[model samples]
Target: MTVKNGRRWSTANAYLRPAMKRPNLTVVTHALVHKVLLEGKTAAGIRYERKGNVQEVRAKREVILCAGSVGSPHLLQLSGIGSKAVLEEAGIDLQHELPGVGENLQDHLEFYFQFKCKQPITLNGKLNWFSKGLIGARWLLDRKGLGATNHFESCGFIRSKAGVEWPDLQYHFLPAAMRYDGRSAFDGHGFQVHIGHNKPKSRGWIRAKSASPSDNPEIQFNYLEHEADREGFRDCVRLTREIINQPAFDPFRGDEIQPGNGVVTDAEIDAFVRSAVESAYHPSCSCRMGSDDLAVVDPETRVRGIARLRVVDSSIFPTIPNGNLNSPTIMVAEKAADIIRGKGALSPSDAVVGMDENWLERQRSGSPERVAM
Candidate 1:
């Protein structure tokens, strides 16, 4: 429940900075988990590799796997707790059959809508060595500088269309035109929005290339495969155009750089999305949580058909939240920590935000009481 002004923080800047100083915690580095040591149907310990040699460590309680969406499932598969077909193909003996282990993989697809700016007030000016030195010097002198923030000055979440339950599309507005990876788009002044759908219906999977833990998994996101996903992206482009087209940007807005003026009509937009859309890189749910037949982990985060083994990461997210993975992932880890400690789940929060039924019509005007008096 930490809050600082209006900005959100990352693990390294928030949690781990103080955590690394704690005397009770032991940090292990460069160790690769070979497999979970299983005694019958129960997870007994861990077999890992370090310095080109295998090592074993017995777990006193349960073996928690927090290797994230891809790594978690890969470990489960290597330890013989995944789809029989995948495990068999990977040269591993099958011990459990969970067809959903590496399935239901989800990630947001994003593209920057770059618009040239008439004014020179953008990050492009700061790219030079002189400006970079000034920014660095300011930060060195005091903790305040341009480097303090990611520079995503503003953001928004909105529904793709009517009848959508909640906001599915997310927008991260950057004052400078650049890729999410920090790749420069132009030398002149410009701005962009890192916008995309959060709850994409498109699905894919992760498969271990072989039995070796070091090998990269075969990943196929199948992005924009479904009609809804494609349509959602189309809405993203249209809606963004509408936002930047507003009177406020008339002074700053210049030419459209991506999907340019020619990229109109459904077909052209579709093609542009296919060409320009990039992974928001929020991979999750390769080991989905549920009690159904395909569920890899149950609601309690325990791997089905295995005792003393649990996965506590984005891999077990029942549904990808309508946002980035950072906050939701941290919340997941916190709740999982409680569950691991055998504590009763905390009572649910009662706070709720009431949504307006006619929000689309009055979106610009925040008039009328949102909830009952």
Candidate 2:
């Protein structure tokens, strides 16, 4: 939840805003980079198209590629730096052979478990245009209202079953029952819990469809292709039901609105999951960093066989983390900046993380003794 002053705190606002006045910095808008101009195996500069005019910009020292998970691979393939077979199939001359350029694509998939609310204390009541306008007005005036927050104030992480080393499932609680596109399923008050398996064994790829820069790349996540992922979603449905049925929710909980009360069998759960699951938009690990034959980037984030070029984004992650990639991607950029400046590695922190003492015996610890207010 990277937010500040009631607005999303993005990298552009934090890092690029103050540096816009620097003499050495230049920012281009509405331009599409067509490809990286190469001299043999070294990156010399880039070719771009802006308003139908093609242009080239030469690099003084080196070129750093930060086009992100989808763009990075697509741009690399367009520049003839990817799997030999893939480039040949796309009718592009091969400049370098990196078989892992667009391989090992991964993402998190989730679904909202919605429930009808017996009480009127839910955001669904404020779905009208008048209520939304008022909320927006309040936030614009002082940044102190329902619109100030994303409405996902509560979250939790827990293991799906035994033998798991850490929490594999993540939860985000919302007080409104609506689709991701803002469409309400019913006309009554409701709530939902966004639950998903954080770690999945499924893998997929992204490939260039053609040599044209304007052509969209082909992406296939192949989610739930593994038996463990299917089992994990079944655990998600059952475990979410257990949490929602607690005594604390008895006063407000009504009938189940999603997947319904009749969807109880294993086959039914699988069918529901297959139809209901949506992408969490955490695509990563396409250009993995390592020393293996399939590795596209090396330990220093540089392209394995290419000189004066590097990748600095989530695509360089050797493996996806258990949580969102936002913070980790920021950390990667900061570390890459330091490395590029020839700075020494920062000392590792000795912070101790808390864990359940009985974690080996149970999936989760018992509820703490609640004290009345």
Candidate 3:
């Protein structure tokens, strides 16, 4: 959440800002990179298109690719550095044979488990034009008020069931029932908890449609393709219902707004999840890092079998984490930077983490007090 002074902080502000003044740094925008100019197995530079004009920039030493999950794999494929079959079908001569370049795509999918609120304390009350104007004015004037925050003040992470080593489900509680695009879902006051099966077993892939970079890649995240993921969603619905129906919410809770009380059976829950779930947009693990045959990059972030070329983004993640990709992606770049500088690895933390001793037997250390609905 790296937020301060009422503004969200991003990598550009944190890392790139200071480096902008350095003589060695050059920032280019509004340019479409066509491909990496390769010298046999080594990356020598890049070819790009700017304002309909083609251009090439030669690298003095090496080429570091940080084009992100989708862009990175797509760019690699365009540069003739992907699967032999894929490159041949796309009418590009193969420069390298990395079968895992665009494979192993992963992402998080979540749905808003919404409920009508009997009380008018939620952010639904602030959706009117006048209220929004006031909120905006306050923030612009003093950098304080409802407009200063993303409205996701509460969140939780818990395992879907017992026998799980760690939390596989994540929650983001929002005080309003609305779509991500700000469209209201309810006519009155309501709230929701964005719940998701974080560690999905389902995997998909991204492939280049053609040799042209202008053509978007064929992306598919065969979500819920696995039975375990479907079961996980069922658990998500039931567990979220149990948590939200506690005595704590009894005073303000009115009725379930999504996956309504009528959706009781497993089939019904599955159907609801299938239609309601949305991407969390945390796509990663395309050009995964490893020492295996399918690995695209090696332990040091260097592209496999290719020198002077490296990928420094979430594209190199061995596997997607249970949380957001922002921090993890930053960590990847930071670690790659240290590796490039020939720095030794940092000492691992020896801090102790608290966990329920009976975690293997039960989801919680103690049973939560429950009342029959």
Model 2 Cα shift for residue 47 (angstroms): 0.7
Tens-digit lDDT track of model 2 for 107-143:
9999999999999989999989999999999999998
- Arranged by TM-score, best first: 3, 2, 1
Better of 1 and 3 by TM-score: 3
A best-first ranking of the candidates according to their lDDT comes to 2, 3, 1
- Tell me the tens digit of each residue's lDDT in model 1 across 137-183: 87667646786677876888877776676778899988898766775
Worst 10-residue lDDT window, candidate 1: 364-373
**Candidate 3: worst-modelled 10 consecutive residues by lDDT:** 364-373
Error of 2 at 112 (Å): 0.3
TM accuracy, model 3: 0.97
- Alpha-carbon error at 259 in model 3, in Å? 1.1
Report lDDT (Cα) of residue 27, candidate 1. Answer: 70
In model 1, what is the error at residue 83, expressed in angstroms? 0.7
Off by over 4 Å in 2: 357-361, 367-373
lDDT for position 1 in model 3: 68
Q: RMSD per prediction, one decimal?
A: 3.5, 2.3, 1.9
